[model samples]
Target: MIRSLRGRLFLGLTAIIILTGATGGLLVYRWAFREAAELQDSVLIQLASLAQNGSFSSGRPLLGVEEDTDVWLIELGATPRGPADDRQLFGLKDGLQVVMRKGQPIRLLLRTRPDGSRFAVAQPTAVRDDTAREMAFRTLLPISALIPCLMLVTAIVVAHSLRPMVRLAGNLDARRADDLTPLPQAGTPSELHPFIHSINGLLVRVGLLVDQQRRFVADAAHELRTPITALSLQAENLGSVDLPEEARGRVAALKQGMQRTKHLLEQLLALARYEAAPAERGEMPLIALDSAVKQVVADLLPQALDRGIDLGFQLVEPHMVRGEPVMLATMVRNLLDNALRLTPRAGRIDIGIYRQDEAAILQIEDTGPGIASPDLERIFEPFFRGSSPEGDGSGLGLSIVKRVVEGLAGEIALENITGSDRSGLRVTVRLPLAADRPNEVSGAA
Candidate 1:
């Protein structure tokens, strides 16, 4: 029932080690216990033989054996000797036998001498059994100690063996949504090859599907451009003929709608094109980031003047970044377009381009009503206009800018600037700087 492979493997291996250790220990204990008992019996028989051969004086009990052994020598003449319990042992024949002494059982080895005299060497049954049990228990010490060491080794090995799978999962989790690179199979276990192959196959299919979707969107946008252009021209042609004021207003409105539709189609095509192309660092060249920003700002200056908005650079520095110039221009254009749409007439917009910590930094601050807190997080979603939407925006400006920034391996952040008397939004972008740069800081204006 264990769901984790690590848990199952560890549990099963531990159980096997414990079972094997216990079974082996039990068998060894039994064998050792029997051997010890037989050896003790043989020692008693040898002592009785030595006593009968005059190795010890008659009528004297031997005391040379270890104190804990509790062995004793008894000499019984032609009749019984000692107490009644001791006399009962003399009734037994030669060789090893069990008899009761002082109501406690004892092992006695009886032997007859050449002179027809008889003697016995005896050991207490309890003491002899305790010695055998101690020897048998000692036989299990090695296996008992080895089991824990083996269990420790097993746990370490299991974790080490599964490390690759953990790393592979982390790699997958950390990948970008559009990333469809196949998983690497090198250095992985042979048993995992089939699983890796399946994942690679899935990635290939997913990449193909994404490519098809991008192509469809791009093709559709391209197809719609012609009709939208024709409609705009037809509306424009109506302006040449004299007409009533009401008719003129309707034609103007129709022209505006056609223009908005055309803009939307163009944005869709741009987004699809950027998504379809793979962003490779080697394919990108080092571009002057500050120059790109200046060009975008210059292009929008006329629009700003028409709306009575002050648009100019606050700071400009020679910063270089790796990306296609057209893509960079597109990103800057989208950001400026969004800012221009949101800022009211007579508002001021500040732009900054500089180098910070080996990165090219682009920051734009606008004097306009800041984005609502509820919509701030989702502002970059495609076609997601916040509550109290601003002028005729397709809601795709910020989304397009975000896609372009990410495609260039840059980061973008949006936060509302707060103060007691002022409110606006600050947009900050940081892109990895190129390897070379001009050594000079342009003064802030």
Candidate 2:
């Protein structure tokens, strides 16, 4: 019923150790018991031999022997003549025998001398058996001690043997959602090779499926571009042909809708293209990041002016980073456009680009309302406008920017700017600096 492999292995090994120890201990205990009994019998024989040779008198306790064994001398005359105990002992033949002395059983050795008198060496049966059991019991102490030690060793070995599998799971959990890299098989145990191979095959299949989905979106967007453009043209033509005032207003609305549709198509194409990695990364040029950012700002500057919002760079540093110029431009433009949509008239938008650590940092701060705390976690997800969406803006801008940043091997973070005087959103991006870029900092403007 145990579900954990470690628990099951430990339990099984513990059971095996206990069973083996019990069997071995039982065998050794029986052997020790038999040997102890034989040794006691030999002691009695030696005592009888010594008693006959020595000058010991009748009913005298042996001086040189152990008292706990209750071995002593008993003199019975050549013929049985004393109490029931002595007479019974004298009735025995030579050598060791179990006999009753006064109704109590004793281990006795009877011998007859050359003078035709007899003597017996005797020990109580209970005393002899108890001494033998004590010796045999001592032999089992070591095995009893080893059982717990073996169980401890088994637990440690089970955890050690499974550490690699636990580490593999942690690595998988930490991977990015878009990452489909195959699990590595080298340096792993041979037993795990089959498992890793199966996971790698799964990753390959998932990657192919993702690629197919991206291509489908890209192709669909490409096919729809022409018709959306024609619709926009027709709407523009209608705007110019004056009609009833209500008809003019309707034409303007139709033109706006067409513009939005065109924008959505362009965003879909950008997302699909940037989401897939470039076919040849080496073909990308290492362009100046500051220069590319400035171009994007210039293109969006007129839009900011119409809204009466301030947009300009606060700091710029010369740095090179590898990426397509169009891709990078799209990334910046989408971000700025999102800010412009949410920023009220006369709001401030600041842009800064510089080198920090091993990365080129592009930070943008807007004086608009920051996103809802609940929405921050999923803000980059496609079509997820916040619960309190400020305008009729498509929610694809941040998603597109995220894809472009990932394609450039960069990280993007959005924090709610909190202060006593103001509150808004601060978006920071960190891209790996190209190897050939300059690292010197420039004075802030």
Candidate 3:
């Protein structure tokens, strides 16, 4: 499991302070101990020198002599023979531990006279004990008191450094689900800005998808309810039909309306699926524009012939685009289907492919009751109905066309081809040119 950033930072900062304090403490201790030993050695050497050179006030032998008080000096022969003599000589030194029967640890200073006789002066360990203790206490005691203060300061610094992250976390925790706005992190560290920016991007995308879903659901319900209610009414009417030609015609019209409603619902479902995907639309068939258009026209030609409309193509060039063949075909079929259904008998409809400015353009123009200027853009929205001669459409057709064009990174635009009365609807589609195709005609015999 991942630990929080604040906790990790605090731990790391505290550890650094601890290491620094430990290193400083070790150095201080070493310096204090070495200085103590040096001071003791200097003081003892000086006292020993004074003892060797100076004489007593009485001018007699101060060393190896007894005194009225315990404060007296002692001088011992380097090679003493008897225990009694050594015990008597040991009493001369004041407050010194001297074992005359063995070697003693004392700082000795030697003085030489003109007669070449040597006198030795010694200060025993007790002479400098109190001074050494005082020096050690003075040097090391303050450092011992500083450790706690250092720890407190380290903790404070760590807390201060992590306060921003704490606030950021709290801000995030208190947010509502509908909050798509960015987190209010004005003073955030540079190290975390990329993460913040990435999250904001995610929020934007998710918000868009959520809005789209809401619209889809609302529109689907509104469109589906009308047909379902009509069907229910039709079923009621079925029980009361004492059939004449007029009654049968009403039933036939009702059945056709039901079929149209079902078709519209299916189309809406497809549009929803296409919009809900989070990733790129997957690969589709490599279809030639001419062939795909020709096929759709072939399928719908019978209806056109029945309406006495002349549906023809202008293949200025053969161009191919990458798309889901089914979706692309649907898009073309819907556009042409709307045109054929709306155009009056003897109306001429043109399907043409041409290139302009390095893009493949498919133009579908029909001399039918063209869309009004205001309704051109609105017609592409789902379930929209235009005041025209054609039967009411599922309204998903144009929307499906738009979705397919966007999925393939293409564009669509409509213009009124009529001279003055807004009588012809012209739709132009532009697709990107293929980049990795061989320079030869494809699917050519």
Candidate 4:
């Protein structure tokens, strides 16, 4: 319920100080009062002893004594009171303590003279108690007064300590809704620097992704608009056709164009969906890697055979992983399709699935001209197609594979596995093993 951080900090600090001060003050007051009472009693007893030794001789108390010393004299006017009571001597002192009444504490020295006379010197207990109380109050007053000052200083320190958070909040508040600029701060404490740097890095990534989305939408609209308009124009032209052979040929060409346009549109939609989905969905089901790989290989075998390319599976295990089956299938299908599309006639393509420690490994190797090392990294980027003799491609296959791999918390690597007899490319996909599986047969089982 204590929302204001500074307020809470000040209160906590003040509470600690007050408790410590009260405890120390209580201890000092008790010790000082006890010592002062002892000093008073010792003075009273010593004075009484000296008086009894004839130190106070005549009618007066003492020689050269200050006028402040009040010594009471009591002569035995009539000694017929009773048997000498020792208790009476105990209370009687060398000095008068007239102000200290019955039941009131007093410090007094009492002496019984040789002639059955008594003399006493006394001071009230109130004197020592009052002095002790006054000293304690004096010490406590300044500390109590300084509490407010201490609170102010504490508040300032807390504010300075939290200045970075305040600045970050202010920056966020001032930013535009669409602004994804990195937060700017300098001289921030080291403890908070990592948080600030993380935020800045996130902003940079989100900003680039937003920029990419904007460009993708614009380009998609532009790309689809032409084909859509062409289809509409062809539909319109069809109604006005008159000749036989010539008109039929025109119709066929227009139909082909429409099909191409439709295919392009579908690919664009798929790419958009791949990009727009949440980076991580709630949870994925466990899918068998062998089954997924074999399905993909089977679906692409016809295409591979059409080009005289050999395609087969080399699975070491039916590795199971947590993944969206459709997405996993898409990734495998794209990798195989990419290989089959580029591999020359009589080339060999190998697909394998197995568990490797805590990961599921899917490796695809194709006997195609290996990607030049410089272009390997760029091949997975959207709309990137390397120098392959095969004609135009939509360039989204490897990109889709990369996106799906990342979405499933997996990794893929491409390397040249070319040999003396064949030049080829190798792709390795590694997905994190399911949490329920203890030891994967691949390694460290």
lDDT for position 206 in model 1: 94
User: Tens digits of per-residue lDDT for model 1 on 78-185?
Assistant: 678777865876688888888887788988888878887778888889999999999999988888999999999999999999999998899999887788999999
Question: Ten-residue segment with the worst summed lDDT in candidate 2?
Answer: 436-445
Q: Indicate the worst ten consecutive residues by lDDT in candidate 4.
A: 74-83
Tell me model 3's lDDT, rounded to 2 decimals. Answer: 0.66
Error of 2 at 320 (Å): 3.4
Residue 425, candidate 1: C-alpha displacement in angstroms: 3.9
Query: So what's the TM-score on candidate 4?
Result: 0.47
State TM-scores per candidate.
Answer: 0.82, 0.82, 0.48, 0.47
Better of 1 and 3 by lDDT: 1
- Per-residue lDDT tens digits for candidate 2, residues 1-445, read 8999899999999999999999999999999999998999999888888887747766767878778888878888789898977886777789888887777788888889888899988888888889989998999999999999999999999999999899899989988778899999877788999999999999999999999999998999999999999988988888668599999988888888888888999999888877766643456667788888888788889999999999998999988788787788888888898888888999999999988999999999999999999999999999999989977677899988887787787999999999999988999999988766344322111
Provide backbone clash counts, one per model: 0, 0, 2, 10
Against the reference, the lDDT scores of all candidates come to: 0.86, 0.86, 0.66, 0.69
lDDT of 4 by residue, 296-341 (tens): 7777778888889989976668667776676777778778877887
> Which portions of model 2 miss their true places by more than 4 Å?
55-88, 92-134, 167-171, 181-194, 243-249, 277-284, 437-445
lDDT of 3 by residue, 167-191 (tens): 8778878664445778655898876
Clashing residue pairs in candidate 3 (N, C-alpha, C atoms within 3 angstroms): 64-75, 73-92
